[model samples]
Target: MVGDALASSPGGYLLVLAVLVPVIGMLAMPVMGLLRVRHAASLAFATIAVGVAVVGAVGWRVVGSGEALVYGIGGWSPPLGLALRADGLSAVMMAMAALVIALVALYARPQFAAAETAPGGRRAFGFWALLMGLWSALNLAFVGEDLFNLFVALELLTFAAVPLVCLDGTAATLEAALRYLVFALVGSVLYLLGVAVLYARYGTLDIGLLHELAYPDFATHAAIALMIGGLMAKAALFPLHLWLPPAHAGAPAPASAVLSALVVKAPFFIIVRLWFDVLPGASHEAAARALAMLGAAAILVCSVVALRQARLKLMIAYSTVAQVGYLFLMFQLTIEPGVPAWATIGWTGGMLQLVSHALAKAAMFLAAGLIAEALGHDRIDELAGAGRAVPVSLFAFGLAGLSLMGLPPSGGFIAKLLLLSAATLSGAWWIAVVISVGGLLAAAYVTRVLKRAMAPPPEGIVTSPVARSRELAALALALCAVALGLVPLQPFDLLAIGRAGVALP
Candidate 1:
C-alpha cells in the first residue's frame, strides 16, 4: 500500500530541488558576504526568486496532475531509504512559505542593505543566511517522508528561528531567544522520544510504513501523546504558548512576520500528520474534543490578552495565538466517519484559516514595523500620527484585520463560516459558539488599534516618512489574504488532491 501510494511521479525531482535550493543558498551566503557584503543580499534574493519558482512549479504539477509528486533517494523505496513527497497540502504549505519568505525578504532589503565597507554587515548577512536556512527547513518539513527526516527538519527549523529573535543583540531579545530555545528543545526531546518508540515497535521510521503497521497499543498511544504534547508547546497552543508573544514581538519586523506566519505552522502541520496519517484509527473522539477545548481556551484567553496589550507588535503577537486556535478546532469538526477528512468542510475551513492568517499576520507585522519606524515607537497610544505618516501601512493593517475579524469578502470570514457550518451539522454547539465569539473578540482588538490610529496626532509630535516600496510589500500580502475570499465556499478540490481514500491525519 505504501509503495503504491509513493511511486515517483513525472515531476518528483522538483521536491528534491525544493529542499536543496535554499540549503545551497544558505551555504553560499557567508562566502558571498566574505567577498562583498552587499553581494550577500543579492545572493539571498536570487535564491528567493528561484526557490519561489520551484515551489510554484511543484504546486502547479500537484494541482495539474492531481497526484503526489514522489522522489525516493538513490532510487530506493521507503523503509530502507529516504523520500520527498509533495501532495496537495505539502504543495500549498511550500507555496505559502515561499511567498511569505519572499515578501519578507523584500521588506527587509532596505533595512538590512549594507554598503561595500559597512562596519555592521554581520547583522545584515546573518538575516539573509538565517532566512535561507529557515526556508530550507520549512520545505523539508512539508515534504519529508521519513519520521526521523522530519525530526531533522524540525531541529533545523528551531535553530534557524532562534537566532532570528535575537538578531538585534539586546538583553531582552536575547532572553526571549533563550526562552524560545528552551521550549523548542523540550519539544524536540519529546518528539524524538516518540519517534524512538515508534521505531522500536515497527523497526521503520517511514510515515507510510508506520501508517500501515501502527496499532492502538499502549506504546503507540503513549508515544503519540508525548509527541502531541511536545508539538502543542512548539505550536504555542493555549497554556504552553508563553514563549510566543515575547519572541515574536522582540524580533525585527521581517523576522517577526516569518516567525508568526510560517515558523509556528510547521509544528502544527506535523501534529496534523501524526494524528491523521500515522495513527488515524487510534484517534478518539474524546481526545479530539480535548484538543478543541484547548483551542477554545486559546481563542478566548489570547484574544483578551491581545486587547489589553499596549504595544502594537505585542498585540499582533497575541493575536497569532488566538488565530492558531482556529486550526485546532478542525480536529473535532473533521471527525465525520466514512468521509475523507480533507473532503470535509472543516478541513477546508481550517486550511483556509491557515493560509489567510499567514498572509494577514505577515502583513500586520510588516505594517506594525513600518508604523514603528514612522513614529520611532510601537506604543498603541501614540499611533495617532500613523494614519498621517504611513497611511498605506495603516490601511494595509486594517485590511489584514478584516480577515482576523471574520468580516465578509475576506478569507477569514469564509474560513470561519465553513467551520461554523461543520459545527452546526455535527451538533457541536460549543465549537460553533466559540467560533462566533472568537470573531467578535478579534473585531474588538482590531478596532481598538484602528480607532487609536485614526485619531489626530498629539501636540507637537512629528512623524517620519516610510519608504513606499516597503509599505507596498505589506499591502500586497494583505491583498492576497483578501483575494482568498474568491475561492468557492466549499471543500476545495485542490486540497483534496493526493488525499483520496486517506482519512484526515
Candidate 2:
C-alpha cells in the first residue's frame, strides 16, 4: 500500500518527487520528439498518473497522522536548508490540480491533434509541457517553506500562464498578454520588496522561522501590507482586476479554464498563508476592512458588468471576478475574536468556494468551448437553439451555472450560506447584504444564457455537433462541484488539523 511506502521512506524526497515528476516530463518532451505519437502520449499519461499517486500518498499520510509531512532538504532543518511541508490543505490542492490538469490534457488531445503531425509543430507539445510545469509550480508554491523558493515557483507559474493568454498569436490576444505581463511584473516587484524587508527584519526567509520571529512592529506591518497588496493585484481583486476579463476571455478555452480557475488562486493562497500563518495575532483591522470593501465593490460592480455582457465567455469572466471578491470576505469575517463558531464556518466556506469555483469554472469554460465549436460563435443573442444541437454541453453549462448561482445542493450554495452565517455572527451586515445581492446577480446572468439557449432559433439556424467525450468531460467536473455540497457543515477539522502547531497564530 502507499501508506507502507510512505512509512518506510526516510525523508521528504517523495514530496520533491511529486513536484519534479511533471517537470521531468516537460524536460523530456524534446527527447521524445523522435518517437511515435503514441509513445509521447503514453509518456505524458504515465507521468500524470504517477503524479496523482504521489499526491494521494502524501494526502493519506497527512490525514491519517493528523500531522504535517515535513522534509528538510540536504539533511538540514529550516533556517539553514529548505523544507517541504504537506498539510491537509496543501495535499488537497495538489490532488485537485493534478486531476484538473490530467483531464484538460485528455480533453485537449482531440482539439490539438492536428498540430501534432505538422513540421516544427511544437505549440501543442509546448502547451502540454507548460501545463505540467504550471502544475508542479503550484504544488511547490503550496508546500515550499522558504519564501525565496516560493518566489521561484510563483515566477514559474507566471511564465507558464502568460504564454497561454496569447497562444493563438492574435493581435488582440497579444495585447491582452502584454497587459497581463506588465501588471504581473509590478506585482512581482512589490512582492520581492516585501520579502527583502521581511528577511532584513527577521534574518530568515523560512515561513515557520519568520512566523515565530514576527513582531507587530512598523517594519513587519509595512512588509505585510506590501506583500498583500502585491498578491491582491495578481489575484485580480476588485479595482486591480483590469487585466482579468480580457485575458481570460481571449485565451483558448482550456487555457482560460486553467488561468481563471487555478492560476489566480495561487497568489490568493499565498496571501492567506501570510495572514493566518505568519502574522498570527496581529490585527490590521483597517487594512482588512479595505480589502473587504474592494471585495464588496467587485461583487456589486462586476456582477452588473456580467449581466450586461453580450458574449457568454466574457460574462463568465466577469462572474469570476465577482466570485473572487467573495473569497476575500472571509478575511474580514474570520479575523474577529468574539465571533461565534460560525466564524470558523467562514474559513471552511472560503476554501469550499475556492475548490468549487475551480471545478465549476473549468466545466463552464469547457462547455463554452464546445458551444463555440458547434455554433461557430459564442454570442449570447445568436445562441438560440444551441441547447438542442449540443444538449450535453448546454446541460453541463447549466449545471455549472447552478453552482455559480449558489443554488441548492451545490457547493457554491453551501459556501455562500456559510459566509452569510459568519457575517451575521460577526455583525458584518454589509457582507451579508453583498452575498445575497451577488447571488441574485449571478442568477440573472445564468438565467439569461439558459433562456436564449433553450429557445428556438429565429430562422433556419443550424449548428454543428460536439463530441460526446468532450461534453462528458465538462459534465463530470460540473457534477464534482455539485457533489462537494455533500461534505458536512462542521468546522472541517481536516483543514484545521496540522494548522494548530504551526508557528503562525
- Please name the candidate that would achieve the greatest TM-score relative to the true structure: 1
**Global lDDT for candidate 1?**
0.91
In candidate 1, where is summed lDDT lowest over 10 consecutive residues? 1-10
Task: Give the lDDT of residue 90 in candidate 1.
Answer: 92
Instruction: List, residue by residue over 17-42, the lDDT tens digit for candidate 2.
Output: 88899899877776777565423445
Q: After superposition, how far is residue 176 of candidate 1 from its true place, in Å?
A: 0.3
lDDT on C-alpha atoms for all candidate structures = 0.91, 0.83
Alpha-carbon error at 281 in model 2, in Å? 3.7
In model 1, the clashing pairs are 276-505, 277-505
Per-model root-mean-square deviation over C-alphas: 2.5, 3.3
lDDT at position 32, candidate 2: 71
Best by lDDT: 1
Model 2, residue 386: distance off in Å is: 1.2
Error of 1 at 383 (Å): 1.1
Cα-lDDT of candidate 2: 0.83
lDDT of 2 at 338: 55
